[model samples]
Target: AQPRRWPLEKHEYKRYGRQLIMPEVGLHGQLRLKNARVLIVGVGGLGCPAAAYLAGAGVGTLGLMDGDTVEESNLHRQIAHSTARVDMNKTQSAMEYLQSLNPHVNYNRHEFHLTPQKAIQIFEQYDLVLDCTDHPTSRYLISDACILTGKTLVSASALKTEGQLIVLNNPPRPPGDALGGPCYRCIFPKPPPAESVLSCGEGGILGPVVGVMGVLQALEAIKVLTARAQRPANGGDWSTNGATSEAAPKATLLMFSTYNTPQFRSVRLRSRRADCAACSAQSTISRQSLTSGSLDYVAFCGATAPINLL
Candidate 1:
């Protein structure tokens, strides 16, 4: 006789007994977390902590994508890597650490930059995307890909002593809804003049600051995936219940300054411009038309412009 098929066992609730006790995240929430899949696009300062926490929290599957290798300088902030993995790929190092944290959680790693062609293909496989990249170009590219694919994007950014986090679900617009909330492009219609901005290499960052921001990023991802109850009437166009009524869903821009006096402030995002180069057909179509030739995003991001040399 053939051996009897064994019944699938339920998740080890005892392992997450404390989380189960929380009113916000009880048994049901834990189950939801176990079923969710999240994609983190970078394994640097921000991604390291966010990915660590999410994996520890029992996210069903964690996807880590990064093309860089660990460096001696990165050890100060990127807590996921160690001196032993100094020259290893960021994704591999992150995966090894996450696996050790929670062996039950499924971990996937991609040692490649998030190119346009790879964005849609990879994003389609996951339920949510986390923009943990440091550069503005990668953030915008991920945002555009999320919009086109209709995926929830939990976007965050950290530099120096501050950071910002936002959830963009691409809520459905009502018929003839002319007042659309900003996309990433609405806030930054174009990449800033390359010379105007400095990288983390030029401007130093605090290790702990990135840690706090990354934790918040992971928290937001959990809230979004578990469908947590929202706070009452914050007076924002975006619905607290994650619903899109007649009003356009708002985009929030938060700033943090940690050098002199630590502070967090929310900046109002302007309405979307119909003529935005990134959103407008004039810009996207022209770029998409270059199928026969290669497109250099670094140049498109203005990083390779003449002014960037200065």
Candidate 2:
């Protein structure tokens, strides 16, 4: 006789026991997590902690994208890459740690900077994306790619004790869909002047500021992944009663600061902008423009001259 099969391996029940027992992430939710694919771009301060939590939660597949190698300076905030792993590609270093955390998760290492040409093809492979990068050009590229491929984006950034979080292109609605949530461009129609852009290395980033944002990114991702409409009561398909739905989540800009009296605040965002360049009905951005090098995002953002003496 054929051997009996189980929905989850026996060890998995014990491994994800805590979350597996919660209504928010019961058996069904755990299964969703196990089947989902998430890509994290820029495995630095924000990506490190976010990847750790998601890996522990059993996200089936994780794609880590980064071109930079580990540096001693990264130790202060990039938690996954260790001192021993210094000089290694960021994705490889992070994957080594994540594998130890959860042997069950499948990891892909994209060891290259994200470019407009490469964004769509890579974005298509994953269910969702985390924009852990700290620059605006890459932010626009990520958002546009997520919109084109119909994938939600959980993007966050931290610099000099301040951090902000936003989920863009949620529900993965296609271009011209009025019901679609806003893309990054809809909120900030223009990138900040290139001269004004500052990297964490240049301006400095507080360790916990980014750590908090990254953890929140993982939390939001879990919410999005496990969110299921309540099934008919007659079926009783869910393993437990805790998995229930609420009204769809609103798109809000979450701002954080450790020094502020009120450390957390949210600004509600408009749904979709009809005139938005990326996701709107009259969008000027298209797959062709993105892939053809005609878009010229770097030029759009401008390249600042090196200041020999600031």
Candidate 3:
């Protein structure tokens, strides 16, 4: 079969000439990337880097979601926007930057906060979803939506000088497999109570640290989309060292100190709790079952207290 021609324009060739020369990302990979669609939630420190890299890499469609507007404080880390863009909707600013980065890539903006319904609706249209939000509530919500929709989620988080990344549901399991890789709920079962952990607003963060992790998130998303990396082993377990096992899913958490040294630790995530309000009812939690009251993920992860007075 003749390889499909990539409708490349002159400017695209000139712009991506270096990348186009690489064996891994030659015309074929570029084309594949150009045809792919990725949804990114949040346009803060982390989302800025991830979205920029993905757009520059030739992802065909980019969807950005964020209800917040740019603020003066964001100038330190949210690199996609500028001092001029302060007070602009983050989604709008990000979309403009992405378009400027690659006109061949289509940019979609959702200038709205993510809700359970919104997460499911928009996420279903994309090949992959990127979580770059700082709030645990948003993270769990995005995770659950992705799991329920069977969409691949590239989840990343950062604070102070540390960050973490993971790929979920790339080669997702069938609904009832006990050994299936753990869902985000399996890793965090509930959302933390508000104000338990210091918000980025209260706690300062190093800008470049988020840049590093966000790029990694984009790289993982690309690897999953292009079949470059094997899906994480069942039970959410993966090893950079190539070790394989049947244990519970393990998350690689990396902590970075101001000295620039990074400490790596792994945690084996439990599979669904039989009592877990999210995944316990079925092999997978139904969309309707994911209401705010269905799970206390924040408390489950020991990140925060329940919001209720109880």
Candidate 4:
């Protein structure tokens, strides 16, 4: 018989006892989550909650990247930062809180802006990417880099009383089959015009709206990393053995509104486009092209006002 997938040490069993007993997250699934590596961009509203849960769940490696420093104003929605951490780097602040929550996980602090030149190199080191930044430039930059690196991306955003979420570029089943899900470029090939974009700082996001979406982002990440079904050695039929095949990950847009009447709308997105510049066979973006400074994601996405947290 195969060895137990997640051979929980005594401390691990004690720490994750509740989760380990869940039917969906039995030994195998928990092991997958433990070995997963996730890179989260921006330690603001979305990143804060998402990171907190992912850390609490015992993901093996968590990479936190942010260029901003904590501000008094960020406390309302950026839950990871505290009064004492004001003026501290956002990545460092979040890391400090997350380590306190679960020191068993490894945390990486990237204390700078995620420029196109550095995006691919950094992205390549992680198994998955989460887009938590509030700027259009960073959105396009993260999406394109994920496409180039073949990493699945769980992207979410919140503004005012609403939030949006999506999963992109999941690995196809059977491994080398076909690309599983559409990438970010597959849905919004172009970013919104500079003046049309709004962020939490400018539009005033509801604290709970971002918190819910961030938790959902973490949920999606867990689903992606740990949904593989395993079978026992009794040679039973997969279906009859109570091990149903997992559904293929789809590209969908989740729109959530917390106005007077809370509402949600999930729309299935289109499949990968053959002409997509980032993930297509004839695409112009490549490792060489990226290294040579050929992609102008910031300009392509249009110029936006500098984010102000005041």
Candidate 5:
């Protein structure tokens, strides 16, 4: 629950030996991961692979958030769930797998859907957040919470054979900071038409498609945490996760398609919008509005509510 006060165990040095050798994740970087608290807000396709890698990498605190239960249908793409785990709370199922992967890492099980009232409180406990949920409503809610909590966000989604990824709220500066990266609302002020929204259950995703996106989410998270390992020397603060120095890096959106001229395309993103309601200077969103549930994310986004099986 706190930055690791002790040192990595002797086993950890060997466990993370491969990454420890890399300049990107040297001894100090490995320590950053051990002291990191990461939250994954969905234990489905994307969250599964993302959590696996983070656990394997020895992230100290791994928070699994989901209200759904595992089912036979999820076995195809939800790699962490086993046949025996069917009908188990998703967060519980993931915790079992992740804990097994690395018993040294701590695990938190949040067996509830992320609502506006709980978003900020939950996000405040973690240093970084992964938006692995499938719906636009959840995406918007997650982003807003991350922005409000000043936590960096690694968000991704997959449908059918395609997946998209974007990192938001980097350097997680307070609203109005020109150097801060954009939030979900800045890039997508309006959600897609309700009729256009479709779940993987309806659209059909290939097993590997979503998994790829999830793995990429873990990679970005490591980059963010490990980058912070070098921050103390540069005077970067904790709010930014010390992912970068004085200024936030240019934001970008990565698109991956199973069938395309190029499998990967990187699209540069503009800085936080001056009027973004979530992460910009002229914003109207606040902790009060979020906690009071004044805004209806599902209605606003016109997306299907996730099935609540918990």
Candidate 6:
């Protein structure tokens, strides 16, 4: 049985009229969004737009986690920060804008870098997590932490004119079934060499590319949160019939190349790996591992950062 949903207020119904009219997202879906608790781990590029849309959609609890301060150069892509807020922590700046967009959302600010020491603790507070950080170390950390905590993860990456989106480790539709999708480790067991990793600041990015990916991140999160209890544990393809069919909602990887003739391609992904160190039957990443700080995600990812959470 699905849990009871809170009723929408008269003002809320009026506010979200356009969305409420959609057959896929009527009153029930909107209520699910309103009750969701989402944590955004970076307030730049991807996080800004994702947080903005989630707030506007009335996600009940929105958490902003980032340690960096806003810089003048970030104005183009980080829409949540303003000229007046330059040099302020990104979390604070984003929160200022988000609250203005929807005061109904309960905002939590984590004005610190997402270190492994705090990743699991903070992730436990949210039903879903968005990985918008650019650092290789941070990405691996977020991925591992989400798998460890069993939180649904919507992770996206944008570089130049290219963007990628995937939903990972969502809970199975039926309560005790195997994991619904692959964890980040199943796809990228090791991060790229540090020398080859270039952030948006270093390599430059088309604003619209990241914007598009960020918006899709929010859309995926909404779908996962509102989906029926019997929805497939795996990913599905987008069909003319939409995701109503049984085979419509399986795990798929989206690759967006703005330069290509057909810019978007969705490839169905395989099931979880039995040998995955994080989410497998004999997984090494456990609560004990986390508590002992035994995992070396930074080193495993070939990152050169000094992220010694242990």
TM-score of each: 0.81, 0.91, 0.79, 0.88, 0.90, 0.88
Model 4's TM-score against the true structure: 0.88
RMSD of each: 4.9, 5.1, 5.3, 4.8, 5.0, 4.3
lDDT of 2 by residue, 1-310 (tens): 9675878889999999999987767899999999999999989999999999999999999999999899999999999999999999999999999999998999999999998888888988999999998778788888888988999999999999899999887766899987677889988898899879988989998999999999999998988888777544444345566565443334799999889979999988877787999998899999888888688777677757532110
lDDT of 1: 0.72
Q: After superposing candidate 3, which stretches have Cα over 4 Å from the reference?
A: 1-14, 178-180, 193-195, 228-251, 263-284, 290-310
Q: Which has the higher lDDT value, candidate number 2 or candidate number 5?
A: 5
Candidate 1 residue-wise lDDT, 18-112, digit = tens: 77787667767887888998999988888999998999888999999998899999999999999999999999998888888889988888888
- Candidate 5 Cα outliers beyond 4 Å, as residue runs: 1-6, 228-249, 303-310
Screening candidate 1 with a backbone cut-off below 3 angstroms (N, C-alpha, C), the clashing residue pairs are: none
Best by lDDT: 5
Give candidate 6's whole-model lDDT: 0.81
lDDT string, candidate 5, 47-102, tens digits: 99999999999999999999999999999999999999999999998888887888
Q: Comparing candidate 1 with candidate 3, which one achieves the higher TM-score?
A: 1
User: Whole-model Cα lDDT per candidate?
Assistant: 0.72, 0.87, 0.72, 0.81, 0.88, 0.81
* Residue range with the least summed lDDT across 10 consecutive positions in model 3: 301-310
RMSD of 2: 5.1
lDDT of 6 by residue, 153-214 (tens): 89999999999998988653221225456777777777788788887878999988999999
234 in model 5: Cα distance from truth in Å? 18
Q: How many backbone clashes does candidate 4 have?
A: 0
Write the candidate numbers in order of decreasing TM-score.
2, 5, 6, 4, 1, 3
Task: Give the least accurate 10-residue stretch of model 6, judged by summed lDDT.
Answer: 171-180
What is the TM-score (0 to 1) of candidate 5?
A: 0.90
